[model samples]
Each structure stands twice: as structure tokens, then as C-alpha cells.
Target: MSFTGTLDKCKACDKTVYFVDLLSVDGITYHKACFRCSHCKGTLAMSSYSSMDGVLYCKPHFEQLFKESGNFSKNFQTSKIFN
Candidate 1:
């Protein structure tokens, strides 16, 4: 049997994300609503967000948790891949 309607899943909510609700970051994907700051739970957008490893966070929280490094998460890299 072939699999159906269950290819991609959200890293945060662990729910299947349809194309319409999909929000991809780096290589990982999430439901648009599920994509939020890890600490504050604030909403995140494509252009202005930060990440650690594969975890998502708003810029402020990123700096707060990771400290004001000017450029957050060097090892994992920040969310600067938008183009």
C-alpha cells in the first residue's frame, strides 16, 4: 500500500502540515500557526526569525536565551537564509 496525506509534519506540534499551512525553515517545516518563538510563544515570519539547531525563536528571545551575541547561534546558525 502507498502512503497518503502524511508526508511532512510539524517539528513543534508534531502534526501533519498541508501545503497551504506549511512554513518551511532551513530544511524543516512547520504549520504556520505552530511556528512560533520557543521561549515567548510569539508568532514568527519568514524574514525575521531566529533558530537554534532546528528550534525556532523570535529575534529577541534568541538574543535573550542565547545572549546578545549580535549574531545568534553560530554553531547551529541563525535564520538568515531568507532570500
Candidate 2:
């Protein structure tokens, strides 16, 4: 998908940052370079991945992110958000 490439609010820096890249995996839209750590909510290292796509995470955040991203909760719970 094509991205407009703009400044987005960083969850860590809490300020507008220019997105330098994009991730296409999650299919969710956010500033390409603005993704936050799925655990501690910090920034993920760009060097951690060979390519930027979908949901990527820093080493420490991957496990939880993986579960959540995969909708592991679907097996045990329900939320109005999904309805």
C-alpha cells in the first residue's frame, strides 16, 4: 500500500516524528516508522528486521506482540471492540 509519509506522534518521544519507513504486515495503518514496542511501549529497532512490513517488534516485545497480534484472546475472551 502507498503511504503518505508524514510525521506521527511517537508513543515514546511523545512528539511528532518523521516516519522514515513503513510496515505492511499488520495491515493496520500507523506512521511507518512510528511503531512502538508491544511490551514496554518503547521504540523498536529498525536494524532488528531485514525488511519493514507488518507487525515488527524489538526483541523483548516480540512474544507478547505475537500473541496479541495473532488474536490469541479469541480462544478465551470476547470484547465489544470486536463487535
Candidate 3:
């Protein structure tokens, strides 16, 4: 099959995304407007963000969630002391 098109579906909205309006992260493509922090619903167009299990989050929210889940360790200070 020969395919020659520059269209992809936005991972968030499942809508068509043209090449010019596409934003890619971690090999997933989203419409520029659809790329947002899943927690706060904030736009992530020009800021640092993280993705977990296919969901996007801003740095602050990412850290907050991890901290709340007890997955974020503050033991770095203790490790430093031991070293």
C-alpha cells in the first residue's frame, strides 16, 4: 500500500492534525492546542512537561503527584550524608 499524506490523529482529541499544526512528544502526535497538562488543564506549548502512562503533565503537577504517591523520595539528602 502506497500512502502519501501528511495527516495524523491527535492523541488527545482524536481529531485530524495537519503537519503544520502537529506537536509530537514521546513519539505521540497531538494537535498543537491539544498538548496540555492533564492535571491542571494548562497549555504546555512552550514549557517543560512530563508524560506518565501516556498522560501529559507540567513539571509542578508531575512532582506533586509523585510526592503525594510517596514515589518521590527526599532521601537524596540522606544519601549524600552517607556518601
Residue-wise C-alpha lDDT for candidate 1, range 1-83, written one tens digit per residue: 95467589898888899888888889898999998987678899987797877777787777776554555554434566666
Each prediction's TM-score against the native?
Answer: 0.70, 0.30, 0.73
Task: Give residue 19's error in model 2 in angstroms.
Answer: 7.4
Q: lDDT tens string, model 3, 1-83?
A: 86455668899998888877888887898988899997788989546887777878888888887766667432212222343
- Alpha carbon lDDT at 65, candidate 2: 43
Q: Which stretches of candidate 1 lie over 4 Å from their true place?
A: 1-6, 68-83
> Considering every candidate listed, which one attains the maximal lDDT?
1
Runs with alpha carbons beyond 4 Å of true place in candidate 3: 1-5, 72-83
Which ranges in model 2 have alpha carbons more than 4 Å from their true place? 1-29, 49-55, 63-83
Error of 1 at 20 (Å): 0.6
lDDT of 3 at 44: 90
- Pairs that collide in candidate 1 are none
- For model 2, residues 12-61, the per-residue Cα lDDT tens digits are 33555454544433334345556665435565554653112333456544
TM-score of 1: 0.70
TM-score of 2: 0.30
**What is the Cα-based lDDT of residue 81 in candidate 3?**
36
